[model samples]
Target: MIEKEGFAALVLRLRAEGVTDLDLLTAFEQTPRTQFVPPQFASDAYSSRTIPIDCGSFMEGADLAAKILSKLQVRPGHRVLEIGTGSGFTAAVIGRIAERVLSLERYRTLVTAAQIRMDALGLRNIIIRQMDGSSGLHGEGTFDRILVTAAFSAMPRFYADQLVSGGSMVAPLILEDERCMMVRLTKTGSRFEREDLFPVPYLPLASHIAQHL
Candidate 1:
């Protein structure tokens, strides 16, 4: 858990970095990063660096996570679909803003732990499942917003089909130049608009689900 002073300082730093959204900042303050990381990395919870978690996956730094969520612009009435539940920290934060969050993880261990954290925080609107997100969540109906924590080598067209009209999806994609950059795709009826945000070092999205942790 972050002390009051620590959270205040973190919020101030985020504001300085341009994450001034009031609701987003409140979500960040309410969701403790320490609860989503391993015990050994608890002290590094508030740091601007990724930390290893169970199932060999890594949680993105708090600052980067905040920036991505801010760009996604999740509203209180939007239903969010999160690909990669990681430490459940991101989903918990989204839960504070979105109407509902469905987070998918490939590892069962990660899914179980994420669910426990969400329940402990009294975030019942967030649902976590162990499933391969390579193709996105088809047949699961449409979503108002989608956030993918992993990098995709190419545009995930399948996910685009699952988005509602005018919905937006934020994710990291590998450009032709071999640089992984954060990109956002907004659906406008039958077309999707692309917007490159920033560069990020994110793990590639696994094609297959893990059979074991």
Candidate 2:
């Protein structure tokens, strides 16, 4: 398993790549990635790679996570919403930097597992919920920031509507032929602006609706 010093080195590497926020850096340092990683991959926890969780979902790749967090610019007064809680690792990271984190997952099993992991780590500010994240949690009030761990093919309007004015959002956008890009969005008044960034590969964000007869 990787030690604390090794994790620090990873943080430094991220800083070199422009993830210079002290709050985010400290969060990465304090929260052990292994806590949220699957037991089989615990040894490589500190490495900058994607780790798979159960149910066909994968944790956000380290590079992508760093970029999203740094770009979100989560402040102490911010309430952040996470669209995918793969392993709960990113949620914990955001919780340490922001005031509170509310994560939505499409899979109920993953939500339960993530909740258990978060509870074990004593991360109280982050809440994981089982819901269709693509639909957005618009009924739950606005958020100061939003981070999406998976890729969306189209702009999620509900997320934009739920964002507070001046708030920022970072997400991975999927395109055709195994292509994807990191997108940063800012909400101003009733409008939203999108800024497409460097390409990155991330698992697709699933969309679904429930029905009962």
Best by TM-score: 1
lDDT scores for all predictions? 0.89, 0.79
TM-score of each: 0.96, 0.90
Residue 24 deviation, candidate 1, in Å? 0.7
* Per-residue lDDT of model 1, residues 73-154, tens digit only: 9999999999999889999999999999999999999999998898899999999988998788887799999999889998
> What is the alpha-carbon lDDT for the whole of candidate 2?
0.79
Deviation of model 2 at 173, angstroms: 1.5
Off by over 4 Å in 2: 176-178, 209-213
Candidate 2: tens digits of C-alpha lDDT, residues 1-213: 375866777777787887788788788877788777788887767776777777777776565677777877888878999988878888888888788899988777778888987888788888888777886786788899988877888777667678888988898887676689888889987777989877876777777622220
- How many clashes (backbone atoms < 3 Å, residues ≥3 apart in a chain or on different chains) does model 1 have? 0
Compared to the true structure, candidate 1 yields what TM-score?
0.96
lDDT of 1 at 142: 94
